[model samples]
Target: MSEGPLDDLDRRIVHSLQQNARKTSASEIAEQAGVSASTVRNRIQNLEAAGILTGYRPEVNYEAASYQLQTLIVCTAPVPEREVLAKKALEVPGVVAVREIMTGTENVHVEAIGSDGDDLSRIGRDLDEIGLEVVDEDLIRNEYECAFHGFDVKDV
Candidate 1:
């Protein structure tokens, strides 16, 4: 994934924004990058238009919502059914994130957040019903104690 003609200044701007998307202003970014605020804004818009900046999402403290249970699930499936399986996994309640990995066995990994043990169990059973072979489940003990953040998955 080649980037545009992004100099060190551009990289710094991007990195700073990635750290704190909402709090960091264009003026602040420009000051940090030693550029004008308008320049920073223009560069950001360009990056977004080029699909380099996908989205801006707010970071949340899931513990406040009682999002206690967290688990990492590995899903295995035939190559041809990869997309279908992934779609089904998305429909599974409490599943937070899913990724198609490079490993030959499991085609996708699902991160599920739930309220309790029963909620996690329900998600697991739902995944199984859709023919997603569950290879592993690593439960996270303290979800509220965890700092939760989202990512802007740039096209890379």
Candidate 2:
């Protein structure tokens, strides 16, 4: 991704923040990014105001939270009704994340979590209940812990 007005120092601060947002301090961020602490603080605040920095959150253990599964459900629906389908998909429980991906096969990628196998199964069932034309579905059993990493949690 292209860095808009973010200089080298700003980029460094962003990278460090992305690695661990909650624990990163302005002074520490400045040291890592090679800038003044105030600069780091101001930049972060500015980014937040611009909707670039969303919020700081800890990486919670899903298993500890009773969430034990992750599945990437690749789905296809009518192109004209894509917005409607996306809206309906959001209502399904256990669906933590959803994206309208541009791919050769599917138009949507749903990243969801469930309490167990049966919970994930219900996610698929719920989608069907809402009338989404699921051409195919792929469920990956999250055996170990998992983390979400994307630009949504960071800016370039």
TM-score of each: 0.81, 0.76
Question: What TM-score does candidate 2 get on C-alpha atoms?
Answer: 0.76
lDDT of all the models against the reference? 0.76, 0.71
Quality of model 2 by C-alpha lDDT? 0.71
RMSD of each: 5.6, 4.7
Q: How many pairs of residues collide in model 1?
A: 0
Candidate 2 regions exceeding 4 Å error are 1-3, 141-156
Tens-place lDDT digits, model 2, residues 1-156: 444675556566566677677777899977755678999889888878878678777665677787767778877766776678878899899886677765555787777788888887788888777766566666664445323333232343
Which runs of model 1 end up more than 4 angstroms from their true locations? 1-5, 141-156
lDDT of 1 at 115: 83
Q: Measured by TM-score, how close is model 1 to the native structure?
A: 0.81
lDDT of 1 by residue, 69-147 (tens): 6789888988888777887799887887788776698888998988888988889899999989888889765543221
